[model samples]
Target: MSSTRKKSSRGREGSKNRRWSDRVTKQSNALDLESKIFKSTNPRRIALSLKRSAQASKRRKGTPYQSAMSMLNFYINRAGKSLSQKQKRVLERAKDELRDVFGRK
Candidate 1:
């Protein structure tokens, strides 16, 4: 049987990431993202960075907190297990700080 899928035009050979979500994470037009926005060790810093990105983005329709949390959750879900326990803890706390900074309960 023949496959109907067309070949991807992105990436070089032997690319392990063939998932569409990877492209969304990299190429999403949702916000003003800082490079390595998710790499920071400080929860508050990560939250604030996400908040800044969320607020500054013109393309997002949700409230800033929603956008920020969405992006944070996306990162947490996407980077699961690959993230160290310390890194995961930081990000989880970042969510709390994100709520605090946004005045959300």
Candidate 2:
């Protein structure tokens, strides 16, 4: 029988600067987020879309509310200093809207 060789790590990842967190946000086992959902200016729309996605996703690890909120927080936190003040405000408002949609007070 022929022996099998182990795979190499070199060039296995697409980019040198790529981080595991980046890959998780883009291609995780969680919800399949809408394209550019974070770019929306309307908070309610963002919340509603998140709710819909979370409710429909069987892959989410937490409750729909929890998963959606976590995903939103993850994007905001990951964006960090690069996120614009205006955009950040919109996203924060979306969190509030999300809570309201879920009736979580």
Clashing pairs in 2: none
Worst 10 residues of 2 by lDDT: 12-21
Write down the RMSD of all candidates, one decimal each.
5.5, 8.3
Give per-residue lDDT, candidate 2, residue 79.
Answer: 42
Q: TM-score each candidate.
A: 0.77, 0.78
For residues 36-83, write the lDDT of model 2, one tens digit per residue. 788899999999999999999998888999999998898889843478
**Which prediction has the highest TM-score against the true structure?**
2
Model 1 C-alpha lDDT per residue in residues 2-79, reported as the tens digit of each score:
988987777575466656556666677897777887778999998888889899899998988888898889878974
lDDT for each candidate structure:
0.83, 0.86
Stretches of candidate 1 off by over 4 Å are 1-17
lDDT of 1 at 20: 53
Candidate 1 C-alpha RMSD relative to the actual structure? 5.5
